[model samples]
Target: MILEYSNGLHVGGDSVKAEEIPNSKDRKYYILARLVDGEHLSYQRLSNDYFISRSSIAHDVELIKALLAKDNVSLGFDNSGTFISGGEIVKQKVIKRIVTDLLRAADDRSSILKLFIDSSSITRVEEIFQKQVQSWQLEVPEYYIDDIVISTAIVVDRGLLGHHIADAKGNQLGSLLFQFDKYPLVYELIKGVEEAGVYSFTPDELRYLSYIVIGNGFKFFMKDLQIPASFKSKVKLLISTVSDGLNIDLTQDTRLHADLTVHLYQMFLRLQAGTTVINPLLDEIQENYPQLYGTVWYAFSDFGSDNHIAISDDEVGFLTIHFQAAVERTKSAKRVLFVCPNGIGTSSLVSAKIHRILPEVSLIEVVSQVDLVRQDLSDVALIISTVQLPAQTVPVANISPMITTHDMKTIMNRYIDVSMDGSEQEVDFSHIHSIPFLAKDHVLFCNAKSRTAIIDSLMAMNEWPNAEQRNMFRQTVFQRDTVQSTYLDNGFVISHGDPSLVSHSCIGVAILDKSIDWMSNRADVVALLMIKKEDRKSVEPFMNVIMNGINNKDWFISRMMEISEHD
Candidate 1:
């Protein structure tokens, strides 16, 4: 006979009931939690607790050990039972993942607390956190409250179980984040945790709790004003360096300055707390925008050293995103010509509406259908008309008198692909950087004896799909070099190939351990601007950056030294 269970779970035996049923995933989580909590979980005890067969429990333990190994943790056996051995940070990550997965698997929020923490402890943390946020009159997002509470619960559970972040026996905490150290609200939150009387936090744990508070979408009103002076100055210096190196003045862009300052403040705090924010687009950015990535990486030389901290490529990728956006903001908007068969008033309305919808685009002119054919169409990047138009080189968008949401999306998607002027348009440096081509790993410092070895080394460093593609890329670069030297006068060469040779647009840079001769020019550094032939325009801005630097050799050499020194 078959049996049914509450909450839609099921079993095949008549004897099994809702309360008695067990989820194998839940049991695995329980086992992991026990190990993480420093409990001696033997096969016998786990089987008895879960009312599962000893064999089944043993299999689950082995599966968990395999999983732990993936996280750089080890599950070992002793005379007593099973024990877990790993650094505190690794343990914390595993524990958090276990709780999170359980929460998702159960499709219930309370499952995590029931499995790892008591109701009273959960209630105490929630109440104290709520009162503290309220007392401080801080505006934290409503959804973030649950995350804050969960993080607090994990801290309390781990702290009481002897996984202390202060003593941090097997783990190293991030360098002390000074920005939030002196905040009065942080002290209040600590006081609330102590008042609970169930557990106390060390200074580091308290700071971490504050990190939880800030990390979960809490935006302080004074965040902009609170930017550390030294941090701001360093960011300014870097931006200034890039501006001077590329001859593109970024300082005048107040919007970029303000936005970058705020991002750096939050990023610095996270770094200080040893929490590295993950950038999902790191790989794509590295492969596509190699030049921009290398340039930005050079920009922030004092990033980790000044704070006495080590920064990860993930952090550098995040910073690249901010600077990339800033560069795009400075570019001229793509010009689009609007047409209407109706009177000028209707055309004017369409123009105004399109402007509101696409603030990034410049509405060059409003022309009648006849005028569209008659007027100079050479300047137009796109043609938006109420009526159908004759054959045209530029993209023609046909829409109603009033542009709809669908119409707006159509224009945005097509505009990027269709350059207004038929022939390849002059590159918008700001626009090209919008989709990054370089990642941190693509740029490297190499010790090569000759130009050929350096080229070979770079080809090996870049992760191509196969050896065939690498050979083609290497041959293409060499063939091009033979035709005419790609070397610039100032100790550098810009090596590149047709788009078909490269899977994606990227720039790989190598600061040679020693100088090498290239035809007539002798150089120690080489930049390979590998791009898909279709994306040849992206090379223009980078070439301009190098040539601009070439104009001021001292400026270029100084920047190159910064890169070599960091290497």
Candidate 2:
């Protein structure tokens, strides 16, 4: 018998055992009344509310569970307690199934089925049929039932097919489909139109049609017709049919020139659709008709359109400023020396102004000509000097004596920082003890050849007093030349590799008293050599300090002239 159980009681049919079932009528009424009042019931509270033991309530719950399972219905427990699960239609199915079963028990299955089918309960009928088919394992033939009924129901109940038939040219199609809670009946209708030889349509027309199909179902003839290959031709026939039905005269109206206008609209739609097939067709048309393609693509092109305007002027300017600032920041290092002629107070003012602006830079006093000649400053990293010092001296920034404070800041920031915080102190080189110079019997002068021969000869001769001391000497003098090629402007290439110069363990100095017609700059130079193997390492640091120290323009010139005079 068709009896539906809700909670713990039989609801619809007489076949239920009332004595075995709990009287859930009061419970159902109470729960429904509470729900109506914006209150909900819980399973635990329900047990306590009825004044029944929990086990008795559990027993009643089991019977109700079995009854609901027969109709594929369920009850769920949440913060609201036991509630009917699934859609409203699912609950309706349980009720309808019970009614149908009761009718069957009364031997009225045919009348009940007829009543269900005749009613506007298409969804209920489908659900009942599906349940029966599933339960009995019946093979229901496809196409017997109404496809539109099922499809439309699914469309309305659950969103589907919306994306397929949306107006592709419209920007909000994605957002609209996302909010779609119903199945896309309109999309299906449009697909039917496509099937009925109306594939081509203007975007506006498609949008209008979409609204119509969604609001009202399509006409029977529209659904029945098959699509033609030439959609424009089909659309012309349609427009003509409509015009004829309305008896409208369109002799002067180009819109009534259905074939041409419809075809153009269809082409516009295709372009917006971004269909892959159209691109190849366009390419072929251009190739076949070069003059037409040229007119369309180039000659008649509108350059004044908003899309063609240059858009990045402000953005480019912003990027240029950002890059300039970054480069200026990167150029700023620490330690600088300023050198200029005396009596131009501009250097002092520039240095003072730079110090005020950039506390990070330490402004050393400007060195005058006298100071540049006599100052023994070898610790400076950058020399910001207006005076033209020789290149061998140091890396210098040549600035005018009339330079502004801002210009001085720019120069100091570009080259090195003059004012550094005192936390980072300068390196102290005071602990490195200097060794006394030892006299040697045999001295070797290197022009160019094998340095290895010179080293070997020095070791064999033992001319230097100590091996340890001698090795240090060789390092300072010989190995330094290997790091960089030594070239003198006097056409002489002095390197440690000369074999003729290898027989000594002592370093010797040679000087040219006058400028030689030797190389590009015509520089006559003083030459120095080291001839000891054990002294190599010690000799390197010593030479580095001396060469770097003598790189001061005034100091180098004075030392060179002193050697030349002695020679």
Candidate 3:
């Protein structure tokens, strides 16, 4: 074994020399860890253990004390020994810091398990947990089970080490656990730990274990936990804000409100405990559904400010799942276009009859056969035409010149259960380009070498009416990125600003000189599609066209190559 330093000083020996002792930072960390684990190490004791002088240990103690003081913790020495002093809240913060380092050190699943569980005892705990899960028939998401297992193992490990939580909060949690202690699955979990016989648990310790179970989305906790009304009210208010902002009605969904309220309640509890929740589906959700992620973030970004509890992206991702499910629950209005062959009178009559028959159908517009062929009916759900027309992608309802009851009934039956199945079709980008939002002038050929530089150059265009608008747009774009990356996998980023900041929506094309690690993805970012706020959802179809083009290898290469050459 050898000791080495950054300065290339190496001593080849079995034991480290006095001069090769650990640095101040390392010594402080060791002392802090010992104190966190409830070890009362006096200056004399530390000096004797580390083969260091009392003076050296005393200096290290002062350094550690200064560090602890910054976080409102204190180091004290008495006749008993040296100890770290702080309220439970501050102590929990320090514990969280230690746990974070340990988790980081455990780079693999096996290593993580070994950190808090005996290798021989792991199989026993696994079998007990698995059996209980099977017996309860609870559909716990697979990703969350790891949290439950790890948390339970830590409780058992700490109990054996005599690190028991006996605070008021712990007592309350324990009493709550006792309410359902008779439940078979809960009993099984407690019995498994008790049967190990290596450690004894206080009621408070048991409650701490139960808290872990609940925090990880256990069904047992939901049945027994009583959420405060105030928290519920805050969640409901947030839902309302989200509903209004997205223009999606969510209040009528009682189930959604209840579910969101409960989830937020548990999230707050976890935050207060300084515990981090991990979401396995975060990457997939962010990539595949960027719009949903953005909307959920917009809705909840203010939640922390109003509630005094910070919410992380992991928690936001979990909330996004709830909102996505809720959005699926709301019935979307069906858009229908009526095509009539004859004059306005006949089309009007047909429209009136169709509305009377199917009230759920929202008639988009009345178009003649010739007019309908020229119109972009991409948004149309169903087209009811009195005249025979050419074959098209959208489902058509062909009826007689005089709309009859049988024809109406036939049309209703054929498309009643119809839903937009997200089938891709050819899109025309002519109108999108024609929109005043983007033009040859709006397109910039920047020599910028980074994402931020390219974005700044694009927003600096005269297209932004004023400096205030430009700054506002800049903030909005970066804020969105902070929530989730706007960079797509196809080597292009589509960034946008708040709708209220812009007079009209347009896409800005920025051909970067090179892509320099935009959101940790490397590529020559060929273009940046900047969208204005109001046009976010409205321009999605156009985006779909762009994405489809990018996904097609030939189109992506030729188009981007053409733009690159021109620049």
lDDT of each: 0.61, 0.37, 0.60
Question: CA lDDT of 214 in candidate 3?
Answer: 68
Point to the candidate with the largest lDDT: 1
| Stretches > 4 Å off in candidate 1 | 1-151, 168-182, 188-200, 211-228, 241-248, 280-302, 355-364, 374-382, 391-395, 402-567
The residue-by-residue lDDT of candidate 3 on 1-567, one tens digit each, is 001122222322245456645455466655565666555787777776566788988778766664443233566567857887754334544543344345545354333223233444445555677777778777776655665665555556555655556662543344555666444465556566677664466765565555656666645536655677887888888887667545687888899898888778777656544454666666666655555565565556556644555556667678878887888677556578888868889888888888888776665578777777687766677888877789977888889978777998967875674553422234554444343345556566556786677777766554667888778867876676554445444566666555567765666666555545554344454343455444444444434445554456356445444443443
Predicted structure 3: clash tally? 1
Candidate 2 per-residue C-alpha lDDT over 1-567 given as tens digits, one digit per residue, 9 for 90 to 100: 111122334332334354543355333333332322223456566565565567755555554544444333456667766665654334333333433343335464342333222223345535543554355453433321233233222222221212122233454333332222343434544344344442344444345334332222222212332234574454344333223322332223344443333333322222232210112123233233322222122101111011121111111122222222322343435455677665557766767755665566563656766667676556555676666787635566666666765666657565544332212122232422331121232223334234344345544434555676656655643443332223321223333322223345333333334433221122233333443333332333223223323234344345434433442
What lDDT does candidate 2 reach at residue 549?
Answer: 30
Local error of candidate 3 at 562, Å? 21
RMSD, every candidate, angstroms: 15.0, 43.6, 14.9
Q: What 10-residue stretch in candidate 3 is worst by lDDT?
A: 1-10
Pairs with steric clashes in candidate 3: 499-533
What TM-score goes with each of the models?
A: 0.51, 0.18, 0.46
**What shift in Å separates residue 554 of candidate 3 from its native position after superposition?**
24
